[model samples]
Structures are given as structure tokens and as C-alpha cells.
Target: MNHTPVEGFSKLSKQEKIDWLLQEYLENNQDFKKVLEQYYNEDADLQKLHDEFSENTISNFYMPYGIAPNFLIDGKLLALPMAVEESSVVAAASKSAKFWLNKGGFKTTIINTEKLGHTHFILNVEPHKVLHFFNFKLKKKLLEATEAITKNMRNRGGGILNIKLIDKTADLENYFQLKASFGTADSMGANFINSCLEQFGKTLKEEVSKEESFTEEEKNSLQIVMNILSNFTPNCIVRAEVSCKIEDLKDDSGISNEDFAWKFKQAVTIAEIEPYRATTHNKGVMNGVDAVVIATGNDFRATEACAHAYAAKSGKYKSLTHCTTDNEIFRFWIDLPISVGVVGGLTNLHPLVKFSLSLLGKPSAQELMSILAVSGLAQNFAALRSLITTGIQKGHMKMHLLNILNQLGATEDEKKYFVNYFKDKTVSHHEVIDEFNKMRNL
Candidate 1:
């Protein structure tokens, strides 16, 4: 399938990129071309806006935009929009939502809402001198220097809140970090945080150079490494929990309520003690969190990095969620550093993102953090329940049957027949293809 490379691929217009790629690789496949074109919005203006989101835009890559309804959070009903391609994610979330709807739904609390960034630099000054330079008086000077950069953020009731000097001389020779915390309000504040850090880095170097108390060696030794935001925002924590009497867990799954609680707790316990299991366990949690984050135009990549770092905060990777059963009551919850925002970035730009935000009544960043945490908790519960009882494959494969049918090019009638056929049977891609071929022949 090797083909000659095209020059200036990035410079090509969207249509030209599509034409060249199709002509080079996809021969005589007007059907494939039409399928891609059909996903584009009819509005030219909106299409153009999407095209400019990234370079070399040939077509819009689509994920199934689904809604998981019946989520009761903080006494409010929310139908979360999940943009994902996985088969069982929406189903799992929906099942969890319905199961907990009558059990007081989910409750969320924002413990703290502070984002962090770092101005990494090398300083060979005495430890005391370094500490004194970042003391109360000097910290104010740092903020003063970045006042112009933080003007808009401060006007919006958010800006650089504090700067702390961290000593890392033991870890690396003369290494240090300037940690800055910010109250970004409703924005993710990556750009704002970075801009402030850059200014602080500049201010720190200047302050050192002019300090009569500092030796010439200390001034020359100071070198700015980088200024950036840290996604592992432990201070921006939110807790989401769902609790119900064990007796209330009765469902069609045939498992007793007490047994269900026991098994679910055990599953979570394994994740806590075993890093191997914990990795995949946390991935399942993100399956729910990332979907809602992406749908609402938040940075899922950042959230993923923060969540994983939080899991390993104890020096060992562990589960993000915990389950407890006491006095005939069952409780499942997760505490996650959910640094999400409901404004800025794509939130205000993308039409679907605005609609997603509106669906949740346009929550503040703290509220959104709670919602995202609960989603992860709910998804984990749903997956664990399936894993311990009927087995994960049973429900997952059923949801996956449609993808198999589509892959084999099943018509509407064939799809209906195969869907019913596979409902009472196991599904496999090869089996689906074989049955599809057999049906066509018949």
C-alpha cells in the first residue's frame, strides 16, 4: 500500500487533502467518500470553523454522541452527553444511573478548587536565602510583577493566588521550583497559568540579579528551565458518592443485595492492593469521565493525567474509587482531582459543546468537577457489578453486535435478523461475518 508522498501536505486545503488522500489510497470508493462527507455539518460556516481546529483537516472524525439519562446529582436530573466509540460505556453509565436514581442518586462535594503551575529554575543560593527570597514580602513582589498579565483574570475574581518556593537541592544540585496556585474560576486557565508563570520566572531572575544580599555566584547560577502548569492538581479535589441500603439493591440480576455489596467491595479492594488490576480499573473509570469531559469541550487528556497521578499519589498506583458496606448500607465513592471548566477553550466556540453545557444547566467549574467525579464512580460500579455477576462479556458483546453487523455490511433486514439471533447467543466478528454470508446465500 505504499504511495508517493505529497509535498506540503499541511499546506493543502481541506478538500485538497481529502482528494489527494482518497486518490492515493482509496480507489473507486465513492461510498466511503460519501460516508465521510455526510458527517460534515450542512452549515458552511460551522464546517469551516471545525476545519481550522487542527491542521490537514481532511474530514471530521465522528464519535457516537450519546446521552446517559436518569443521573440524579445534587437533587438535579442530568442527561450527560458522552462522546465515545466504545460499545458498553453509555450502557454501563445508563444502567448505573437507573440503579441509583431511587437510592438518593449521587451526591457531590467540592473540597477545594485551586489549580497549580510551576516555574522551574536552577538556583545555587543558600537554602535560607532562597527561602527568604520567596518569603511573604518577596512573594508579593512576584505577584506585583505579573499584575499586568493577571489583570483580566483578577477582574474576573481569579488570578495568581500564591507563590511558594520549593527546595529540591537534595534531589538535584541547586535545583528549585516556584510553585504558583491560582483560582481560575470557570476557566481551565492553562493559558493564564502559563502566562503568569512566564512572567514570574522573568521577575525571579531579575530580582536575584538586583539583590545586593546575593553573591555573584548565586545570581549567575539562576537559570530558568521552564514555566508550565501541572495537571496533577490535588488541591482541586471533588468527591462524589452514591449510597443506599443494601436491601434496596434488588434488581433483575438475580444476585442478592448483600452478596452484591460484598463482591463489589472485594473488587475495589483488589484494585487498591494490586497495581496491575488498578491500572485497568482506573481506565474503566476514565471511560466515563473522559467521555463527558470531551463532549463538554474540557481537556480529557489533562484530566486523565491528573486522575492517574492521583491514583499513584501514595507511591503506589491504586484505585480511584472505594466501596464500603456497613450496617446493611452500601456506599461507593471516588475522590478525584477533576480540573475541568465550563468556559473558555472549545466550550464557547463549539455549538455542541454549548448545548452540552446547557444540558447540565451551565454549572460552575466546581459543580462540573463534582459531576465528572460522579460519572467515574458510577461507571466503575456498573463495570464491577457486571464483572462479578453475569460477567463483563455478556452485556458488552451484546452492545458490540451492531458494530459487527455494520462491519459485515448487513442491510436493515439482515441487521434486524442478526440482532435478534445474537441476543440469545455469544457474538464474535468471525461468526457475524459467516452468518452474514450464509444469510445472503440463503
Candidate 2:
């Protein structure tokens, strides 16, 4: 039976593929469009507000995009995106995910550290005498602030787990951090964390202000150098694993299971010691992970920054995932921060964007991340598959050649011939011209 294709989506036309994507984007992000119109359009006064809050704006605001599908994270299936544009990203992740498809899929857990951070001012008053002050009518500001934080989270059934006030008296440069924890269902908790932070900051200034010395300038300077939320996500976490059987991998290629296992093992090991290789190494992981980020409307920039930062936290770049081949099977695993959320911000506001979020039965950040981690492995597998057999460009360059030809207005037959001719060889503009003339004459 021929199933009807989705509206505005044809399996054929490249433009249709892109159109389908755009349609999905619009359907899910209705609320976001208004926000964008108000805040991000070319002439919005939001920039003025940003300047008032901090001198710098958030960097890399433009999201990179790609999709990872056929994923089951924490036993639930999903289709997600990686908001990055780098090569080998989505491919490697999807490849890796597919490789482990037969394994019990991916299992994940979310640890919701429902904590919000608040800034404490260090006035540089008396070199050694530093104080933590509250802005409240009765000087019960801390309690009020804590109660608000707790109440906000509790309303969501997360309920604040704990609250702590920290003072760094030893270092003048080190001020104070107010840590509060809350719950995020199945995600790493970035959404609630960000909202709570914003709420807490506003609450401190307005709900309680006993002493007026706690000025906006000081608080603004303390919380951010850029008018942006910190990438340090305080929400959910994801832990995932993939298992594959050796028999499933063996096909007509006469490629022994042992050979495939040995090659993949060597590749991962070599990646660990070589930064040159490891950059692509982790990119493989992000290929899967980032796709989930974009599909869900979470901050891909933050996730990317955290992953790269974590990679270099040891002072040298390295892989964030582990892979191994056991008796008659292969297994891969990843544990990374997927603190994205389901019910807030751009995800909820943007109509088209909301559709994207809902595609997965309303997944949490870790559930999303786990699906991505597997996809990342799949993407890695695709790259490796190409490397082992036909070389990476054979399939890629062939498809690219036709894409270029189409851009030049190649007709259906022309596109077909151009693709075939370009296969087993690379063509030049002159060759393209010759093909065009020949096709026109034919």
C-alpha cells in the first residue's frame, strides 16, 4: 500500500525536504516568533535592555541544526536534532545509534539537582571585612528569598531539596553563591534552573529590600559579564548505554566480525591519545547529542560549550564516550549533561518549535540526550563505515555533485546522468558545461 506522504513533505524534492523542516519549525514555535519579533528582530530595543544589563551579548546565538532519529532513550523512542552544522556530526551519531539498535536500546537516569544560584555582593569595602547582605523590609530577606525559591519549585511538585548560603571570605575575588535544588522530570533541569535563577534574582530585588546599598549595578556585575544565562546547567542528567550483537553487524561484505571489532577498537583508542583525532572523536558524540538539543529547543550552545569544556577540563582534549567489543557483541556508553526541559521557554512559546518538542511524547533532557548519545555513536559508525570500505567521500561527494548540478538547474534526466557520471570520478565546471550541452542536444 502506498501511504500518503506528510503535508508539505515529499520524499523526493530536496526543497520539499527543507520545506517540511521549515513547516515543522513554524508549527512548533508560534510563541517564540512573537518573542523574536519583540526581542530579536533587526530593530528591537532589546539590545538596549541587554546593554543595560551587561556589556556583552550571548555568543553563538545562531543555532546549528541536524536531525537524529530512530532513537530509544530510557526505553522510549524519539526523533531529535543536533543544532550544529559541522560535517560528520549527525552522520556519526546516527551511525553509532544504528549500530546499537539491537542492544537493549539506551537506558538513562535523570538526577534533578533543583538548585538555583544567587549572587552575593563583595563591596571591596575593607580589604578583609566582607559581609553577606539581604534586601528585605525586616531583614528577613534570605528567608523570604529561600521560601520563594522553595515555593516556586514546590508548585511544580519538584519542591526544593536544599538551600545553602556560601561565603568566600578567604579570597577577595571570590564572592558568594546561593545554591538551591529542584526537580525536573526526566531532564537535566536547565529550563527550571534558568527560570528559578531569573525568579530568584527578581525576588531578591523587589520582594525584600531593607538596605538600599544592594544596587542593580552590583548585582548585574556579579551575576554576569554577558546578559545571558550561565551555561552551567543545574537541572537534569543523562546516563546511557548501547549493546550490539556481532552477528547482526555481519552482512554480505565478507567483513569479518573480528575485523570490524578490531578496527573500531583501535580507532577509539587512537582517538583518546590524539587531540587531532579527538576533536572529531567528540564531534561524533555531539552529532547525536546536539541533534536532540535543536529538536527540543534547549540551548545547544551551552551543551556544546560544556562538552568541549569538560573535554579539556584535564588540560587536554579527549573523548567523552566509551566503546568496547565483548564476546560476540559490541557495546557503547555515554553520560553527559542534557539539562534541557519540556514545558518552558522557546519550546512552549514557539508553535512550530512546540511541535518539534512534542514529537517525542514530551521527553526530558536526559531522555533526549541518551537518544542522542546513541545517535552520536551511529553517526560515528557511518563515518567509520565509509572510512573502512569506500572512503568517506564516495557516497557524500556523489550526492553533493548532484546537489551542485541541481543548483545549476539540471532537469530530472540531467540530474540522474550528472550523478552517475560524477560517480567513480570528480567533475569540473567545464565537464558540467559539456554535460549540459549534451543533455540539451539529447
Candidate 3:
């Protein structure tokens, strides 16, 4: 079937939009409309709010919201809210949290809280002249131009920290950058930073145009390329760590405490040195981190981007987590660079997000960063523990048992039976299906 693209799709109402989608893409299937409408919010106001979150909204895509209790971070016990669909993530985090609870839990330190952005422009002026203006006159003008924008932030002990002029003519013809650092306080300051960068861009053109030091040709050559906030916040860092006596690391994994400690350390070392291992290792860490991030209405994409970049900061992709076993002590930790906000974006609008923040004790931005780092650390520990012990498939497949049962169309009684049956036996897709077929035949 040939489908023509429809114009003015955004101008249509919600039902009209769905009708167009069904006719063009879904062949006007009534069942598709039912499926879309089934997930719509019953409250008209809430549904409208959801629709306005993005364009051409037909329905809501939902993920399971779960809580992992028993997290002890910085001497405070709290339950973490996680939003995800994958199996075993929440369970693994909770298990790790409980394991380390009595062993002094997770300790975190805020290393830095600086975010940055850049204003890119091009000017055909001499490098020395550009530097002189930036140092003496342009910097002040840029700061002065942003005073109104930074006022409330400064009142709250956060604002523009410093501005630097970086020459990039070697990379491109007459290219330059105004690198600005910021402190955002309790919010992820994307809008604030971008606003300031745009002002800087305007100030750059204006100041360079009026400068008597520059010729008319040089002044006209000035072009403001773009102004944007960078998601790669390396200085916005938090460190989460857990440590205990190696002798106390004994578990039912049939391995000695000393052996387990050394093996764990070796696994982390392999990830640190090998790129292949590090990719999967860090993915497990993000499984925990992203869950909490989504639950709290923060930007997971930015968090993920910053983390992977930080991992490869040494010119090679390595593990974000580190482990050490020395002097009869075992330590595991991660220095995560992530930016999150508790008082902005969807925090005030989304009902569940509000509940999630309150559930976390209404933490500040710094506290949220620590929680995110700890979640990543706990997830890494859980994955490594399973990997070094009974193997990952054992626990992961057990958690996956119900999904398999549902796929096989097992009844409630059959599901109950398989739950007990797989308790001791190994679970494989073919074996479960074969056994299920046999039970049905019998």
C-alpha cells in the first residue's frame, strides 16, 4: 500500500491525530486506536499536560516504577525509586544495598559542582588583538550583559564562575570560543547556561564591532556560530565508595573470602585495561544509574553521555568503577560525573516525579549526584558478584522465569509450579518450554 504524507498533522486535535496515524501508518485499524487510548490519562488535565510535553502526542509510553530499599548512603538509610522495564536491575541494586548496609554502607564525597558551556564565533582579526580585548574589555561586557539572567542564581550562591577566551584558529579558520563555567545550585542549569552563552555571543559581536583596535574588514568578518551548553560536565563529579574487612566478605558463592576479594579486584582491573570488558561493565552500572535518573525526572541521556566520555578521558575507554584488595581490606568505588536537578524541568509538573523526589527526602542537587553515583556503584558490585560466583545467567534467568512462563501461555497453576520447579533446577528456554509442553500433554 502506498501512503501519502499528510500535511498539517500537528494542527489536528488528539483524536484527529490518532485518526491520521491509523489511516496512514496503521491501515485504519480500530484495535490500534484502542491500544493508544487505553494508555491515556483518565484525568483530562493530566492528559493535556502529557500531550503538551511533546508534539503529536497520541499516547503515553509507560515503564515500571519500583523501589529498592535498604540503601545506606553517607550514614543515612533511604529507599531509591527506579523506573525501568528490564528484569533483575532493581533486585540486584537492592541486594547489593542490603549486603553493604551493615558493612558501613556507601560513602560519597562531592568533588566538584561546576558546569560549563561555550559560545563559538569566528573573527579574522589578529590573535593578539583578540586576546587583548577579551582580557581587558570583552570579558567584563559579557559578564555585565548576563547580570539579570544570573541574579537569582547568584542570590542562591550559584552563578557564572569564570570566562576564558580559547583560540581555535589552528583547528579552523579564525575560530574562537568563549568558555564559561557555572554553578547551578539545585537545578540543572541548561537554560541558564544557554541563555548566558547567547548573551556572550551577542556581547562578543557588539564589542568587537565597536572596538577601535579592529579594522572595519576584521569587524565585519566576526560571525557568531552558535551558543550552547555542553552535556560533558567532567568537573561535576561525585565519588561513591564502599569498603570492609576482606575476612567479612564471605558469602555462599563457594569461594573463600580472600579468593573472592582478589577475583573481584582482578575483574575490575580487566575492565580498566580492556575496552571490550569495560563496555559491558559500565552498562551494568548505568542500568542502576539510569533507572534512578528516569525515576527522578532527570536527563539520563546527558548523564550517560557524560559518563561514557569520562570513562574514555584517558584516551582509551576504561571502566568507570575501580576495586582494590589490600591489607585485609576490600574496597570498591566509582567516580561518576553526572548533572541532575531536583527543582526544575519535569520535577514540578510530573506527579510521579514529585513523589519520587519526596521519597528521596527532597535531596539537593549535590545529594542527588551522590545518590546517582552510589546507585551505579551498587549495580556494578551486584553484577560483578554474580559474574564471579554462580554466574550471571543463574540469577538473571531466574528473574526471567515469569517472562518465559507468560510467553509460553502458562496458567496461574502452571506458573506456580514452574516457580517452585525452577527454584533448584537450572533454567533454559528450550528446557522450560519442553517441560511445559510435557506437563500440558500429561
Candidate 4:
């Protein structure tokens, strides 16, 4: 195959990119072009708005937006919106919500809400001199220098919480950091934290330029490598928990309540001790967390990164959720570092995001943290129950049946018949296709 690069590929118009790609890749381009055009928003203004969310306006890709209801959190019933492509995620969340509804639901609390950022610079001078400079007066000066930038955040009861000097010489020679923490109130504070760090970096340069505490060599040594927000927000944490009597676990799987509780706890223990199991185990938790985060227009990518970092915070990768049974009482809980925003990003722009936030009673950032934590815990609980009892594939395949039928182009009547037919029998792509063929032939 001969390959040649297209000049100015990025600068090309969206349609031009589409046309070029189609021409180079496909024999019949019009059919695929029609497929792309079919998904374009019918409203011109609405389509333009979606296009500005990213560069190179392609057809709007979509995931099913679903509502998992019956989530009773802190004595309030919540209908959570989840935007995910997986067939079983929403169903599993709904099932877990209902299961916990009668068990006093989920109790959640925001432990803290402090976002962090850092200014990395190389200090050719003694580490002690930099530490002393930060400790003596530079810390206050840094905060003061950023007052203009943080004025609005301060007025809203949030601003710089603390500043510290970090010695990272062990990692890289002459490397040091000015670590700062902030309270961003209802916003995720990425921009806020970065703005503050940039200001601090500039101030540090100016302050060292005139400080009599350093020689000419030390004065010229302070060079800022970067100043940016850290996604590993350990201080931004939330805890969500659910508890019930062991005898209260009712299921059709024919397992006794005691056995179910024991097995569930054992499953979690396995995740805690085994790194291989823990990765997928926490991934199931994020399936619920990311869904709700996306629906609410929060930064799920940052949240996922922070959560996985927390999972390994103990020097070994482990489960994000914990399950236990003591004295015939069952308890499931998770304490995770999740940084999310309720007032910025797409919250104001996306119509569906506004509706999703309003549906949750317009929770503040802290309250949203609790809700997100509960979501992950509930998802983990549901998955463990399925894994131990009826096995995960049974329910998962049932949820996947429709997608398979659609792929095979089964008619409405055939779909309805196969849905009921598979209620007792195991479902698979081949089995569904065979049944559909037999029914259509008849």
C-alpha cells in the first residue's frame, strides 16, 4: 500500500476532512457519508453549538442516556442519570439502588474539599535556602500576589488554604516544588488552581530577583519548569456507606443470606489482596462513577485518575470499596478521593446537564461528591452479588440480547418473541439469531 500525508490536514474544514478520509479509505463513500449526515443535528444552531465543544466537527457520537431510579441517599430519593454505552451498567445500578432502598439506602459525608496544584522549579542553590525562603515570608507573599486572581473565590468562601515547600531532589537533581492547596467551593478549580500557581511562579521569580538572602548564583538558579493543577487530589475526599442486617438480603438465587454475605465479603477481600483482580474490580466501580459524572457534565477523566491513584495509595493496588459482615450485620462502604465540579465546565452550557443537576436538587460540589461516591459503592455491591450468586454473564447477556437482535436485523415481532423466550433460557448472539431465523421462516 502506498501512503502519502495530506498537507494541512488539521486546518482543513470538517467536511473536507470527512471527504478526504472517505475518498482514501472506502470504495462506496456516499453510503457512509449518509450515515454520518443522518446523525447530524437537524437544528442548525444546535449543531453549531455541539461542534464548538471540540475541533474538527464530526457527526455527534452518542451513548444511551438512561435514568437509574430509587437511589435513596441521606433520606432523599434520587433518580440518577447515566450516559454510558454498556448494556448492563444502568440496569445493575438500578438493581443496586432498589436493593439498598429498604436498607436505609446510602449514607454519605464529604470529608474534605481541598484541591491542589504545584509550581515545579529547579533550584541550583541549597534546598535549605529555598525551604527557608518559603517558610520565612515567601509563602505569604505568594498568596498576597495572587489575591487579585483569588478575590472572587475568596468572596465565595474559598481560596488558598495552605502553601508548602517540597524537596524532590531524590527524584531529580536540583528539583523542588512549591505545593499549594485551595478551596474552590462549588467548582472543580482546575483553572482557579492553575491561575494561582502561575501567579506564584511569577512572584517567586520576582521575589528571588531582589532578595538579599541569596547570592548572584542562587538568585539566577530559580527557574520554573511548570505550574499546573494536580489531579491526584488526596484532600478532596468523600465517604459513602450502606448497612443492613444479614437476614435482610432477599434474592431468587436460592443462596442463604449468611452464605451470600460471607461470599460477598470474601470477594472484596480477594480484590484487596490481589492486584490483578483489583484493577477490573475498581473498573466496575468507575463504570457507575463515570456515567453519573458525564451525565452531570463533570470531569470524569480527572476523577478516574485520582480514584485509581487512591486505590494504590497503600503501596499496593487494591479495591476502592470494602465489604464486611459482623454480628449478622452487613456493611459496604468506600472512601475515595474524587474531585468534581457543579458550577463550571458544561454545567451551564449543556441543557441536559442543567436538567441532571436540577434532578438531584441542585447539590453543591460537596454533596455531589457524596452522591458520586455512593454510585461507585452501589455498583461494586451489585457486581459482587451477581458474581457470587447467579454469575455475572446471566444478567449481562440478558441485557445484551437487544443489541444482538438489532445487529441481526430482527423485526419487532421477532424481538418481542425472543425477549420472552430468553427469560428462562440462556441468551447468546448465535442462539438469538437461530431463533430469529426460525421464527421469520415460519
TM-score of each: 0.94, 0.65, 0.98, 0.97
lDDT of 2 by residue, 246-285 (tens): 6666633467777776776677777777889889878766
Clash pairs (backbone) in predicted model 1: none
Query: Candidate 3's residue-wise lDDT over 1-442, tens digit each?
Result: 8889888988999899998888888888999899999999999999999888789888999999999999999999999999998889999999999999999999999999999999999999889899999999999999999999999999999999999999999999999999999999999999999999999988888898899999999999999999999999999999999999999997787899988998899999999999999999999999999999999999999999999999999999999999888788899999999999998899999999999999999999999999999999999999999999889998888888999999988899999999899999878888899999899894
lDDT of 1 by residue, 1-442 (tens): 7899789999877677778877899974788778879889889999999988877776788888999999999999999999999999999999999989988999998898899999999988888888877794558788889889899888989988888889999999999999999999899999999999998888888888888888898799989999999999999999999988888888677998888889989999999999999999999999999999999999999999999999999999999999899898899999999888888899999988999999989989888898899889889988999998988888898899888888777789988998899878877777888888888895
- How far residue 438's Cα lies from its native spot in candidate 4, in Å, is 4.1
Sequence-dependent TM-score of model 2: 0.65
**CA lDDT of each candidate?**
0.90, 0.56, 0.94, 0.91
Q: Which stretches of candidate 4 lie over 4 Å from their true place?
A: 1-3, 437-442
- Tens digit of lDDT per residue, candidate 4, span 204-294? 9998898888999988887899999999999889999999999998766999999999999999999999999999999999999999999
Regions of model 3 farther than 4 Å from truth:
none
- Candidate 4 least-lDDT 10 residues: 20-29
Candidate 3 weakest ten by summed lDDT: 19-28
lDDT score, candidate 2, position 8: 34
Q: Could you list the CA RMSD of all candidates, in the order they appear?
A: 2.2, 12.2, 1.1, 1.6
The number of the candidate with the highest lDDT is 3
- Backbone clashes counted, model 3: 0
Q: Extract clashing residue pairs from model 3.
A: none
- Report clash pairs, candidate 4: none
RMSD (CA, angstroms), candidate 3: 1.1
What total of clashing residue pairs does each candidate reach?
Answer: 0, 56, 0, 0
How well does candidate 3 match the true structure in TM-score terms? 0.98
